[model samples]
Each structure stands twice: as structure tokens, then as C-alpha cells.
Target chain A: MATVEFVEATRVYPGADRPAVDAFELQIADGEFLVLVGPSGCGKSTALRMIAGLEPVDAGRIRIGERDVTDLPPKNRDIAMVFQNYALYPHLSVAGNLGFALKAAGVAKEERTRRIRATAALLDLEPYLDRKPRMLSGGQRQRVAMGRAIVREPQVFLMDEPLSNLDAKLRVSTRTQIASLQRRLGVTTAYVTHDQVEAMTMGDRVAVLREGQLCQVDTPLALYERPETVFVAGFIGSPAMNLIEAPLEDGCARFGETVIPLSRAAARAAADEGATAVTVGFRPEALELRGDGEGFAITVDLVEELGADAYLYGTAVAPAVSGRIDATPTVTVVARLAPKGVPRRGEKVRLRIRDDAFHVFSTKTGRRLPD
Target chain B: MTATPPTRCASLPVSGRRSRRRGHAATGWLYASPTALFVLLLFVLPLFLVLRMSGSDWPLLAGNQGINVPDNFHEAVSHRFFRDSVVFTVKYTVLTTVILLALSLGLAVLVQESTRWKGLLRTSFLVPSALGLASASLLFYVLYSPLAGPFADLMRSWGFTFLGTPEGALWSTIFLIVWRYAGFYMLLMLVGLQSIPDEVYEAARIDGASRWQTFVGITLPLLRPTLTLTTVLCVTGSLLAFDQFYILTKGGPDNSTITIVQLIYNVAFQGQNDLGVAAALSVITLLALVIINIAQIRAFSRRADD
Candidate 1:
């Protein structure tokens, strides 16, 4: 096991003005699984490639287990990678495929065979020892790929969206298997995927990237519950946390005519900066339907039912006077009520949001309001 | 079943009048006449004429005295040179096929390795293949011309020459053939290489296979079909090599560079103009090619099945 560190590593492709991964810094603790997640063209994969030595790092250094290996080739990095597609050698049997790395490293024949067999046994692939990759199903091929990495017993395992190819059901199952395997082996692993759910569920800590910049790195629950930036708050959850502009009014922030109390620090900062407005963000589950409340009344537009929880997508109803209501934004508010507590469509439900759970951000910078 | 009264039809009054139907059949044949005449006139007739001429004591000139063809075939086969030429052809075919495939595999890897400068390298390798075989042979002929320079020096400049002597000539011819065809095979192999998805390579890399391991275990297996086709083409083309030997050495200082086609040309046109023996020799060469092709197909298919 090794601690894989990317110390402000940067990669700029030739002829491109902007670096694909700009000043990227990440520290994966020994035996820790860190996932790098972003949208397509977001440079998450590029970051992984740089670590694997497939692509050169233009600036900074990478260290694995205290060894500076920024310029080392993949073979010399003591790392094995499992790709999105299971790249099993089609010509070789499962056993041969599994033993290839050891053979390349010049392990003796007897030792290589023993290691391959042990790894195959661990992966439940003894029955397929002689079958070529083409003969195996997709999931089986993925396992063989995993087995190949296992035999290497590398300092780090690099997986680039390894489960992205499987069907939805298989993807879930394989994700669990890989997670459990990583836990059992206790090897430092860096997994890259665009799926936030996979990153949240699989990683010990998740790093979010956007346009080649590291947005945030934190524990999954921390990122979801206490996001430091509006981007992180909006990106980390499904149905996304809702953000609304609230004008500073008397010691409270006013949303249309309704006023919600703000912390002294927030109010003082707003007054000191002469800030007129702040953005308020709240998760769907934090809002409850109240028939008669001081909160803004919203008309239900659509509902998404997910068995256990349902989401109410709607817009805030206009006040008695409409000329001053310049923003008519539709907010998708999700409520995790019991399955029996769904409200009818078109109902005007007053909302009561948890004050402590509400996140207030600077309207100018979108930075979260400090306590 | 009650028979209905037959209705008068404009096309045929009686559907089953045998004589009228026979006449209609004759008209159908007449309507299809052009295509039938074309096949017979252009394809079958020529083939028949060749076969007949090959078997008979024919001459290049109509009134020239000709040898009996059976005697010609017997005489052609009885010669030590004919046997030696057949052996030489087989050896050259096998050697050229192996070397060409190896060279093509290497070129395919080099070109497929990167997209940067890939277009430039691919064009350079393929330019030689685009040159006609006869043209390439003539080019080599000039380069190998005694007045040009020492052959050894030229060989060393290229790293090594398979061409040095008669044996060297055989290897040199193979070298030329390999050079002429490597790019063509590389194109085939490039297609094969590109068809393999990138995910597979990533899987191999992650699985801990080094570059060499990945090539042997994944790339080569997937390239088998392309390899088979390229190998067969190189083999057949090398076996029928005539232009290079004819232009380069003109059957050589000791007749050491003579191929089967050269021997056949000598038999038919050079000395006695024995058309009968040359025809017999052509028939033998065609049969040999047919047999070899069948054998190659069988061997490849058997390996595929295994």
C-alpha cells in the first residue's frame, strides 16, 4: 500500500493554451480509495492518466509511497490500472492474462503460476483459467482485468471508470465488489468517473473537478451536507440544492415579502460590505409543507416519485403585487416525506425550511456564508 | 375438379402446347443471346484455345514445324533445371511470405503507435507499395546495376542485404518483395488495429501487461485474419516473380537467378521457340498455384478451428 500524492501536478497538451489539469493537487492516504469525479471534458480522466504516467505532467510532481515518480513510466510506478473497458488479452487464457504482468516483471514461472492461481481463486475465476477473454461475458472479463491487477500487488491501483461499461444492475454489483475488494486489499486506489453517485458511494474521500480545476476535496457526506461553494452545493446532490436571491431587510433577508432571520455575522458582513442581497440555498428534504406559514407559498408544477421519496418541482407564487416580482424562477424543491404523505398537484403549499440547514451565500461571489 | 373452359390469352392461346412452348423457349434463348455469346467468345473460347494449344504441337508461327506436345511435357519435366526451379519457387514463396508478414507487422505497429506524424509515416511506407511491381523491379534493376556501386556497400547501407549471391539473390528478391508489399499489408493491419477498441488496451494495461505482452496476447490474435490474407498475397506474388529476375540479371551470370517463369520464357521464346513445352509448363505452374492455394486455405482454416 502507498500514499499517492499529486502535488500541484499540471498537464498541458501540446498546442492547447489551457492545461487539461491545471495545478491539480490531491493526497490519497495509504489504503484509501479516492475518486475523482467530473463531467465529460472536465479533465478528471486526464488527471488519472497523468498519475499513471500515460500522459506527462508539465509542472509539479507526483509521489507514491514517498518515492518521487512524476516522470516514471507506468511499469515503473508500481501501479496497475483497470480501464473502463476490460482489456483482457483476447489471445491468452484467463490464467495467462492474469500472469502476464508477473511474467513481464521476470517473476519465475512457478511463482507466477502460483500468484495467478491465487488471484484467480480470489476472483472466483478458477473455472475460466483456460478460457480466452472473448469467450467470457463482460462482467467476467472485468473480473479478469481486476485479477490481473491483483496479481501485481502493486503499490497503487488506478481504475478509470472501470464499471462504466456494465449494465445498470451489473454496474451496481461490480461497484460493491470492487469497493469490498479494495477494502480487503487495503491498497491506495484512485478511481475516476463522471458519476457523482459512484464517487460518493465508492470513495473514502471524493475530489470534484470542473474545467480542469479542483473544485473541492472532502468526505462524501461533508461535501453533500456542508458544501463550501455554490458549485459544490449545487453539484453534490440530486434535484440540486435550491438557491434564491434574498434582499437584506431590517436584520432579516427578505424573499419577496417574506422575511427570514439571518445570523448576526451574516447581517453584519452584509451591512459592512453594503451588500444588498444574499443567495439562500436549501436541500429539498429541509423544506416541509405547511398550510399557513411565514415562508413563501409555492404552486406545485410537477412531482417525481421514487418509491421512498418524491420531489415537488414548482415555482414561488407571485405576491398580490406583481410589478416588483422581476424573478419568476421555477425552483425544483424535493421533499423526502413518507410515501403516504404526497401532496396533490397544483396545491399551494407554504414551505418551512430548517434555518440551521439553510445555506446563505454571497450574491456577488457565490461563496458560502461563514458561521 | 371440373375443368373450366380455357380463356383466350393474348400472350399464348395455349399454355401447354409443347411445340409452341419449344418455339417460345427458342425465342428466350435468342433474347439472351448477347450475354451468352459474350461469355463464350471472351472467356470460355480463349480458355479452351489455350488448353488445346498447350496439349498440341503448336508453334508461334502457323507453318513452323512443331514438336509433339506429350513429348514436350515429358521433356520439360525430365530436366534438372525445371525441378530445381520448382523447388526454388516454393522456397522463395515461403521465405518472402514470412519476411513480408514480419515487416508489415512492424510497420503496422510503428504507424499505429501515434497520431502525431502518423500521416507522414503512413504515406512514406505506402508510397513504395503504390509503385507498380514491374516499375519497382526496374528501379531495383538500376540500383543493382554493376556500374552503380559495390552491392556489398549498398547492402551495408541498408543495415543488411539478404542479397549477396545466388542464395543472396533469392533473399534479395524476397527483400524487394517485402519492401514492395509491407505498406500494403500495414494498411490491412492498420485497419485491424484500429478496429480493436481502445478500452481493450486500457484493460490490458491495467491488467499489468507490458507493451510487448499486450502486442503478443491481444494485438496479434486480433490481427490473424489480416495476416492470413497478406501472407497469401505475398506468397503467390513471390512464386510468380519474373519481372525482377528478367530485368535485374536476365537469368544471371550462371543462370542462378532464373525463376520458373524465366525458364518457361527460355523454353518458348529464346532458343527453340518450343510453344508446346512452354504451354505445358504454364499448365503445370497454374496447377501448382491452385494446389498451393488450396493447401494454404486448408492449413489456415484448420488452425482457426483449433
Candidate 2:
């Protein structure tokens, strides 16, 4: 196993105005599974390809282990990639596909066969050894691709949305299998995907990217709990965190009739940034229903019942506070509630934000306010 | 009561569906009848006519007397020039197929990798294929002339005599054919190469496979169907070679370059003018082509199965 590092690596396409991956800098530890997660067109795939040496890095250096691989071809990088489409050689049988890299690397025939058999067994692909890639199902083809990488025993593994082609159920199961297999093998891996849940579940640490720039890199839980920017706070969760832009009055962020008292540190940080208003973010699970007299009122617009829990999507309709216009639009909020007590549509519910659960960010810069 | 109602409904729709399917099949045949008619009129009619003429004692300028079974076939097979022509045709077919396929594949791979000037290169390569074979033959005929050709003096200075001897004439004609047809085959190869996904090459590169290894292991195998087609076309087209030899060499240098088709032409028009023998030779050539094509297809299919 070896660590992979990218030092200010960037990729700019020809005739394009902006770099596809800009000033990307990250150092993955040995045997760690680091995931690059973002929406489409976010340059996550470009970053992974740079590491694979498939894409040329225009500006900076990349190192695999101690060797500078930025200028080297893909073959000399000692890395194996699993493509999104699996990309198994359609003409070669499963065994041939698995043994290809070993044969190419000039391994002994007997050793190649041994490693092929071992990888086949590890992937439960022995039964399909003689079958071509077209004969295998999508899930099996995916395993063959994985086996092809595993048989190489390379210094690092690069996977670009490797599970996207499988059906939803198979994608979930295969992702778990990949995560466990990576752990068992202890190989340094960098996986790129658009699915936040996949990144969260698979990576030891997930790096979030946006528009060719690094937004944040942290543990999945840490990113979910305390995102460094408003983008990460909104992008990291399933029912995305609700962000409300409200003016700060008397050291409190005012939203409709309810005034949330900001921490002294957050207020100081917001003041230091010269921001008169802040964006407050809270997760669906952080909002608790309370008695009508205790909390702000929300008119439920929709309720999604997910068996164990229900999420109420509604609009907060607090009465206008003094010196604030009633004409300002009410913000929509989603709250996770117990399935047993799901409120009906059009019902009015009072909700209170949990203490220390909300994040405050500067409205102008969208950076999180320190607390 | 439920079973009776469902059975009644099913019987009604079954009868309707049967008629509908029959009508659909009839319309399909109607749509296909034009092509079938053309094939029957153009292909089957000529095939039977040739077979009939082969069994007759017909001359080019005379009426057929009657069927003389085996006489024309016997004479055609026994003709002194016939054996030599068949052997020469086979040699030409083998040489042309090998050289053309190798050159086409090489040029195709070279052009496929280049991002700049790709269109210009492709167009230039394919331009010769657009020229009519007869026209191209006529053009090369003048160029190969020893007396008036511009290259004659230059070739003499270089100690080379193009089309002046048997081997020279044969190789000159082969070179002209390669120049004329390699582009067409290269186009076929280019389509095959382009259809292969970029990801496959990327995977191979990451596997540490060299360019040569990838070509042999991945590209050639995946391109089997197109290669098979180009090979069959090249073999058949070379076997039927006539216009170039007729125009440039005129089966000259002691008839060393005469192909089977040229021999058939000589028999039908220039020698005894025996249309019967010509027809017999045509039948033989057709049968040989069919057998060769079948053998090639069978070999390819077996490889595919493996």
C-alpha cells in the first residue's frame, strides 16, 4: 500500500474558460479509502483521472508513493482503474480479463493463473470464469472489473463511479462488498461518485467538490454535523439541510416572529466579516415539534411517510416581527417526525430548533460562522 | 360463469389476432417483394442462363446447336492457358489480400490516433477508391508505358523497368490495385476501430499493456468481423482481376499475368470465340468463390465460439 498526493493539481480543457479541476490539493494516507463527492460537472472525475494519469495535469504535480507520476503515462503509474461501465474486454473470458494486467506486467504464467483463481474466488466469479463479459450480468461484470484490479495488486486503485451501471439494489450490495474488500486488502483507493450517501458509506474521509474547487474534506459525520461552508451543509444530507436568510437584530438572527439567539463567537465572527445578516441551517432531524405556545408555527404542505419515520415538508408562517416587512417570503422547512404521529397536510404545527444544532453562516460570503 | 365469459372474450380476440398477424405478414412480404423480384430477375435468371450456356455448344456469333453435356467443361478444363490462369489468379489473390489488409490496417491505426488533419488524411486516402476501376486501370496503363510515360526515364536512371517483364508487370499491377483499393478497406477498418470504446484502451493502458500488445490482444480480436469482411472482399475482388491486367499488361510478358477472368474473356472474344467454354469457366469461378467464402466464415465463427 502507498499514499497518493496531489499538490495543487489542475486540469483545463482546450478552449474552455475555466479549469475542470482547479488547484486540487489532497494527501491520502496509506490504505485509506478517500472519496471525491460532488454533483455532475464538478470535476470530481477529472481529479480522479488526474491521479490515474489518464487526464493530463496542466498546472501541478501528483505523486504516487514517492514517485512523481504527473508526467508519467498511466501504465508506469502502478495504478489500476475500475471504470463506470466496467470496461471488461468483451472478447476475453472472465479469467482472461482478470489475468490481463498480470500478463501485461510480465508475471509468470503459473503465478498469473494462481492470482486469477484467487481473485475469482474472492469475487465469487469462478462459476463464470470461461464466460465472456457479454455473458455476465451487470453485477457479475462489475465484480470481474473489480477482480481485474485486485489481481494486479497495484499500489493504488482508482474507481470512477464504478457502481453506477448496476441496478439500485445491486449498487447498494456491490458498494458494501467493495468497501469491505478494500478494507480486507488495505489498498489506497480514491473513488469518485455523485451520490453523497455512497461517498459517506464508502470513504474513510469524503472530500466535497463544487464547480472545480475543493469545498471541504472531512469525516462523513463531521461534514454532516459541521460543514465549513453553506454549500456542504446543503449538499451532504438526503433531505438537504434547510437554510434561512434572516437579518441579525440585537445579536439575534431573526426569522419571522421567532428570534434565534446566536452564540457570541458566531456573532463576533459575523461582525468581523462585516455581515449584517446570516444564513441559518438546520437538519430535518434537528427540528422538534412543540406545543403551539412554545415554538414557531409551520403550515404543513406535504408529508412523506417512510414507515419508520415521516418527514413534514412545510412553510414557516410566523407572524411578522416588528421593523421587519410582512411581505418577505416565508422559508420552507422539512422536519423529521415519528411515523406514528404524522400530521395531516394543511395542519399547523409548532416546531423548535434544538440547541446547538443549527449552523450560522455569513450571508455575503456563504462561509460558516465560527462558534 | 367466470370461465365461460373469459373463454368467450379470448376466442373473439384470438380470431381477430390471427387475422391481424396474417395481414401483418402479408404486408411484410409486400414490402419485400421488390427486392426479391430484382434478385430473381438479375441474379437467378443470369445464373441459370450461364448454366445452360455452359452445357451447350454455343459460339459467340452462332446459335446454340443443343446441350453438349461435359464437352464445354472438358474443353475449358483442358485448355493449355486455363490452368496457368487459375494458378496465377490464386497467387495474385493471396498476395493482394495480404498486402492490402496489412497496409489498410496500419494506415487506419495511424490515422485513428491523430486528432489534427484526420479528415484531410481520410479524404485523401479514400479518393482513389472513388475512381472507377476501369478508369483507374486506363490511367495506370499510360503511367506504366515504357515509351511515353513520364517515369520511364527516371526509372531507367534508377535501374528499374516497371511493367517491362513478367515479375515487374505483375508487381506493378499489384501496386496499382493496392493504391486503388487500400483506402476502401481502410475505411472499413476505421469504422471498426472507432466503434471500440475509449475506456477499453484506458483500461488496457492502466493494465500496463504496450501498444503492440493491446493491438494484438484487444484490437484484432474485437475487429474480427470487419477483418473477415475486408479479407473476403479483397480475395474475391482480386480473383476477378481483369481490367488492370487487360489495360496495362494485356496478359503480356508471355501471359504470366493472365487471370482466370482474362482467360475467359480471351476464349469468348479473341480465341475460338467459344461462349460455351467462357460460360463453363464463369461457373467454375463462382463455385470457387462460394467455397472460399464459406470456409472463411466457418473459420471466423469457430474462433468466435472459442
Candidate 3:
């Protein structure tokens, strides 16, 4: 296994005004399963492609195990890629598909067969050794695509949305399988996906990208606990973090009738930026539903009961405090509560922010306020 | 309005299904009538007429002069140029299939690879196919003429006659066919190449496949259907070769370039003026073509299955 490094990697499309991947920098440790996750068109796939040597790194250096492979071909880079669509050769049988790269590397036929059979057995594809790709189901084809990557025993594996084609149920199971498989093989894999959940569940350390630049790169727990930007805070959570834009008054942010006192650093940073407002981000699970009405009031717009975990989705009944009334902002808030505490739609409920559960960001710059 | 899913045919009652089926059948017949009429008038009727003419003493100028099936078959088989024409046609067929397929595939790969000039090259290659085959043949015939053509000076300088001998005539005609039809076949090849998704190539690249390995292991196998089509078309068109020889050689240079179709024409109108012998030859050629095509398709399908 080899450590993959992208030092200010950038890619500019032909005839385009801006680079598609703009100075992306990330260092993946050896035997690490690092995922590049972002929204669509956010350069995550471009970065993965750049690492796999499919796309040229127009302005930066890429290294695989101390080798400056910026100009090397994909074959010389010793990488295997699992495409988003599983791109199994429609003409080749399962065995042929698995052995293709080995044969291409000029490995002997006997050795190729042994590796292919071993890979097929690992993937539980022994019964499909002779079947064409069309004869296999989607999950089977996805496994074969992974088998193609594993059989080569490459220094690094590049997977671009490999589980996106599977059904939802299969995607979850296969996600775990791939993670465990990568760990067992200890291949330095760079996986790309738009799904944050997959990124959160699969990556040893997930690098979140937006607009061709990295927003945050950290372990799953770190990212959830402390997001560096307003975007990251909003992006990393399911049901999303409830970000209520509030004007600062006397070192406290006002949301409807409730007053949230900002940390000393956050208040100072906000004042230093000459900003009047800050965006308060709190996770859906970080809010405590209270009968004492200690926090802000939001009229429940909808209640989603998803068995074992229910969420109350609502909008602030009145504009969050009338004093910041330039535009009369209405914040849609989501709160994860115990299934028994779900309020009916159209009912007003109080949610109090838990201690150390909130992240503060400067409204003017979208960057996190130092706190 | 909410979008409702389309109702399936199985949801209908028996009587409703019968009526729906009747309506579908009527629409099918309505759409098929034009092609059916065209086939009957243009192909089936003429085929039957040729079959009848093959069995009767139907001369060019005289009306049907009773049955002469045995005589027609014997004369057709015993024609002086018959064996030579068959040999020439088979040779031409084999040459044309191999060269056309290879040239078009090469052109396709070159066009596919060249990013900057892809559109320009594709358009230019396809331009030659627009000219009618007979028109192209006539154009080539004039160029080959050493009498009043631009190539006349060059031929005189080099002492090279394009249609001087049997081999020269055959090759010159094959070259003309390639020029006229290479673009059309390349277009077929290009379509086949484009249908292979780009991700497949990316996967190949990461799999460490060299260019040649990818072409042989990935491209050729995936392109089998298109290859089968182009080959069959090329073989059939080459086997029934007539226009170029008729325009350029006219079975001349000691009658060394006679093809099967040309023999049929000679039997009907040039010398024998016997429509029955021409029709008998036409029937034999058609049968041979059908058998050859069937064998080709069977071989391809069996290989695909394996």
C-alpha cells in the first residue's frame, strides 16, 4: 500500500473560465480509506480522477509513495478504479473481467486464474465465473467491479460512487463490505461520493468539498462535533443543522423570544468583522424538547415518524425577534426527538439548545467565528 | 394534477382486451401496409417474374416461347465466361470485405482518437458516401481513361494503365469501391465505437491496459455486431459487382474482367439475348448469397454465445 498525496492539485477544463478542481490539497495516509465527498459538480470526482491519473493535474504535484507521478500514465501509477456504473466489460465473463488487469500487466495465465478465482470467492461470485456481465444482477456486477480492482493488488484503489447504482438497502450493506474489504486488503483507497452518509460511514477521514475547494477534512466525529464553516455545519448532518440567522445584541443572538449568549471569542470575532449578525448552527439531535418553554417557539409544519427516530420540522411562528426586521427572516428548523415526543403538525413547541451543542459562524463571511 | 402511472394491458377485462388487441392489430396493419405493398410490387412480383422467365424461352424481343427450363439452366451453366466470372467475383468479394472492414475500422479509430479534428475528419470521410455508386463508378471510369482525363498525363509518363490486365482492372475497381463506400462503413464503425461508454475506457486505463490490448480485448469484441453488419453488406455488394466494370472495362482487355452480374447482362441483352439464361443465372446467384449470409450470421452468433 502507498500513501497518496495531492499538493495544490488543480484542473481547468478546456475553454472554461475557471478551474474545475481549484488547488485541492489533501494527504491520505498509507492504508487509509479517505473519501472525497461533496455535492454534485463540486470537484470531488475530479480530484479522485486526478489521483487515478485519468484527468491531468494541470497545476500541482501528485505523489504515490514518494514518487512524483504527475506525468506518469495510469498503468505506471499502479492504480485500479471502480467506476460509478461498475463498467464491467459487457463482453467478458466474470472470470475474464477479474483477470483482465492481471493479463494486461503480463502476469502468467495460471497466476491470473488463481488471483481471479480467489477474488471471485472473496466476493461470493464463484457460481458466476462463466456468466457474462449482462447475466448478473446489479449487486453481482458491482461486486465484480470491486473484484476487478482487488485482484490487481494495486498500490491504491480509486472508487467513484461505486455503490450509487445499488438499491438503497444494498448500498448500505455493500458500503460496509467495501469498507471492511479495504481494511483487510489495506489498500490506500480514495472513494468519491455525493452522499454524505456514505462518506461519514465509510471514510477513515472524509474531505468535504464545495465549489472546487475543501470546506473541511476530518474524522467523522470531529466533523460532526465541530464544523469549520456554516456550509460544513449544514452539510454534515441528516435533516441538516438548524441554522438561524440572528442579529447580535449585547453579546447575545436573538431568535424569536429567546436570547442565546455567544461565546466571548465568537462575540469578539463578530465585532471585529464589524458584523451585526451571526448564524447559530445546532444539530437536530442537540435540541431538547421542553414543557417549561425555556427556548424559542416554532410552529410544527410537519412531523416525520421514521420508526425509532422521529423529527419535527417547523418554522418560527413569528419572525425571530422583530428588532432585526430588515427582511423579516423566517427560519425553518428541524429537531430530532424521542419518538413518543413528536408533536402533531400545526402545534407550537419549544426547543432549548443543549450546552456546547451549538456552532457559531460569522454571517458576513460564512466562515466559523472563533469560539 | 397528480401524475398517474400508465394502466397496463393486464388490468383490462377480457372483452376490453379483445377490443384493445383488435385496435392494436389495426394500427399495426395500417403502419405496415405501405412497406407490404412496396415489397409485393417491387420485390416479390419481380422475383416471381424472374423465376418464371428462368423456366421459359423468354427471349429479349420475343414473348414467352413455351417452357425451356432445362435448356436455360444448361446454357447458363455452360457459358464460356461463367467459371471465370464466378472466380473473379469470389476474389473481389474476399478482397473487398477484408480491405473495407480494416480501412473503415482504422479510419474510425483515427477519427475517434483525434480530438481537435474529429468533426472535420468525420465530415470529410462521410462526404464521399453521398455520391451515388454508379455516379462514383462513372467518375472513376473517366479518371482511369488515359484519353481525356487528368490522370492521362501521369499514366503516359509512368506507362501505367489502371485497367490494362485482369488483375489491374480488378484492383482498380476495388479501389474505386473503397473510395466510394469507405466513409459509409466508417460511419457505421464510428457509431459502434461511440456506443461503448467512456467509463469502460477509463476502467481499462486504470486496469493498466495498453492501447493495443484495449483495442483487441475491449473494442473488437464489443464491436462484433457492427462488424458482422459491415462485412455482410460489403460481401453482398461486392459479390453483385456490376457498375464499375460495366463503366470502366466493359468486360474488355481480352474479356478478363467479366463478373457474374456482367455475365447475366451479356446473356440477356449483349450477345445471346436470352432472358431465360440471365434469369437462371440470377436465381443461382441469389441462392448462393442467401446461403453465404446465413452461414456468416450463424458463425457470428455461435462465437458470441461461446
DockQ of each: 0.40, 0.85, 0.79
Q: Per-residue CA lDDT of candidate 1, range A49-103, in tens?
A: 8888888989999999989999777778889888777666666788888887787
Ranking of all predicted structures according to lDDT, beginning with the best and ending with the worst: 2, 3, 1
Q: In candidate 1, what are the lDDT values of residues B1-306, reduced to their tens digit?
A: 233333334335555577788999999999999999999999889766656667778766653344455776887798668987888777777787777788877888898887898999999999998898889887776666444635757666676544346876776666677778888988988888888878667655645567887787778777777767776777788788888778766766567777899888888898767777777888788888889888887877676544
Off by over 4 Å in 3: A317-328, B1-31
Top-scoring candidate (lDDT): 2
Grade the docking of candidate 2.
Answer: high
Poorly placed runs, candidate 2 (over 4 Å): A317-328, B1-29, B155-160
Each candidate's fnat, listed in order, reads 0.56, 0.95, 0.95
Point out where model 1 deviates above 4 Å: A256-258, A268-274, A317-329, B1-76, B111-121, B146-179, B192-219, B266-279, B297-306
lDDT of each: 0.80, 0.91, 0.90
Per-residue accuracy of model 3 over B1-306 as CA lDDT, tens digit each: 233433444455766979999999999999999999999999999999999999999989997999976889888889989999999889989998999999999999999999999999999999989998889989898888888788999999999889887788889998999999899999999999999999899889888899999999999988999999988899999899998889989987899888899999999999789999999999999999999999999988888998
TM-score of chain A of each: 0.92, 0.96, 0.96
Per residue, candidate 2 scores C-alpha lDDT tens digits across A53-137 of 8899999999999999999999899898999998899999999999998888899999999999999999999999999999989
lDDT of model 2 at residue A322?
47
